[model samples]
Target: MLQNKSMIVKLLALLTIPVSHATGQVPIDPNPFWQSGEAGVYSTGMIWRDCNNDGYIDVFFSNGNDMALASNTIYISQYGSLLGTASWYSANAEYSGHCGVGDIDDDGFPDFAVANYLGTGGFSTAGLSNLYFNSNGLPNTTPDWYTGDSIYSFSCALGDVDGDGDLDLAFTTGEGYTTKKQRDLIYFNVNGALQTVPGWQSTMFTEGMDVTWGDVDNDGDLDLAFCYDDVAAAV
Candidate 1:
């Protein structure tokens, strides 16, 4: 049926999934360096975890204040490498875009989520779709939780979905190009909290964007996948 190029690079390396949540790679330095950290490049999305756990690997920059007024940044590690940025989270004008991490409230640290792409050509960039709670270790700048979107949210994801081990958040909205109708949210996390409308919503999807969870069908719970960047508008 399909050709074979090393089985399609081993099924694309088992579907290469690593968007960062515990972070890694800042260690192996033998002259391998890569810089580019002035932070706030009008970012639209960013998430890398390890926020303050310190073992290294950190970075969080999610901004989009209408082109230039950038905010939201936290680049830790100092003696381990990231060296600079730390402090400044969603400073204002609104537009966050797509952001995510985990832990959610399991408390052992790790937490981050933000997707607020509130309309553009249709007007309405109010933006507000967040959930940041790492508290004492630094990650809480108010938003113990916030969710409300229908105009457009790019994508934000956290896991567990329904296994009951905690951590569940998945939001995606797109269709701001106009025609309307587009939804995709799934909060769900009960006992550990994170419910305030959205146990599931899907208007058949439009410009959705990112969003990913596992458990394909071995069927134990978690299962979700959304990808759409539609810019055309007409369904």
Candidate 2:
């Protein structure tokens, strides 16, 4: 009976040691569960959206900047698989700075808009904004429309500001190498294309860097907000 009791005490000691170590402690995995190959070189401005309405989110990436290897292309991934790539404009000397997704034509499918900061023609001449409309819920490589010359676009945002059923675009711009500041633009969607809204440019004197819209006053109307790069005070 004495030997049995001693053996039982040793067993309980081992069990209690493990319980003390595990108290308030959580196990963590140290190894990576998954990995994937690099999609593109010098990639920037990545965004995920439900482009095809298949309930699975898709990804879009822009590979730009380097002239030798830069394709100035947008790569798409659907359902965790690469769905090919498309370039809507001439890739020569073009850096795809930023991109935004929205339904510009009220077609229930998300479209893509990109800002070409510096193109082959150089800063002042090559800056432009391009828009690609999604056709039949698939990614379209071709741009439906592009901004006029000398637009100098940088970052873009999409929203419905006027309570209209269609989406609108607000983009920022600035001189690439000079002190000249550019005005922010608001393009209203009209008849499946973007039209410039008059007197919508920001009156504050600053170099626009980014833009977005929200109803800040609880008035149900969307108010625009612009972020500046050189302004001393918040606007």
Candidate 3:
């Protein structure tokens, strides 16, 4: 215990060491530059990519607050440091923190599929997850397409689930506030748009917090995995 205390003291001393600041550059600390919204109070998730094609990676954060009218925000990068000249794009969303990015429009620029709910109602806020097509190096103000689903969406995965040479979407949802219709869904990519497969049946008909595509079975094809929020135990 004495040796452990000495090691901890040394670590603390190292952390307190003063870092020299470069001209006009922000010094990084042990704390992550990525911070949640509302001064680190409400946060859901975020993505880092070059949204404007300026060669500098930008950032997008989903609002974890369900009651806040503005639920999404984007920050453009300036290529200097993490903190530099950039701007924000804010929009109305409902607890929209989960998101996926891809070039759905085949425009060589990545687009977004952020998990969002439609309408202002607090009950079962799942109406349509947004599909923001890349427009002039930024996400379009209006979504190019929607999944057209009414089920509550917790998160989504965007990839080529069908090996169709393009990206597809997998939407997941969890039961919210005694909501009855919670299910996971997959939409096939067809000519830059998405469509539901005919006669396709879903085994994950219950609650799903997240979804992804992988070859867990190693059958030479991608498989979808539905992730439910639960406590994990490590052995």
- Go through the candidates in order and give each one's C-alpha lDDT: 0.62, 0.58, 0.59
TM-score: model 1 vs. ground truth? 0.32
- What digit string (tens of lDDT, one per residue) describes model 1 on residues 141-186? 6577877544467668888866778888887776445534467778
What residue pairs are clashing in model 1? 209-228
- Tens-place lDDT digits, model 3, residues 1-235: 0111111000001234455565543334544443323332144546778887888877766544344434465666557344332254445455563688788868788887777633356444556677778867777756677666565666777878777788888776655445444556777788777773422336545655667778877887788777665422110
lDDT of 2 by residue, 6-38 (tens): 110000011222323647533433343322233
Query: Candidate 1, 164: how far from true, in Å?
Result: 2.3
True lDDT of residue 46, candidate 3 = 62
Weakest lDDT window of 10 consecutive positions for candidate 3? 4-13
Per-candidate TM vs. native?
0.32, 0.70, 0.73
Instruction: Specify the highest-lDDT model's number.
Output: 1
Positional deviation of 78 in candidate 3, in angstroms?
0.3
Show model 3 residue runs off by greater than 4 Å. Answer: 1-28, 33-41, 65-67, 82-91, 117-119, 196-201, 229-235
| Order of the predicted models by lDDT, top scorer first | 1, 3, 2
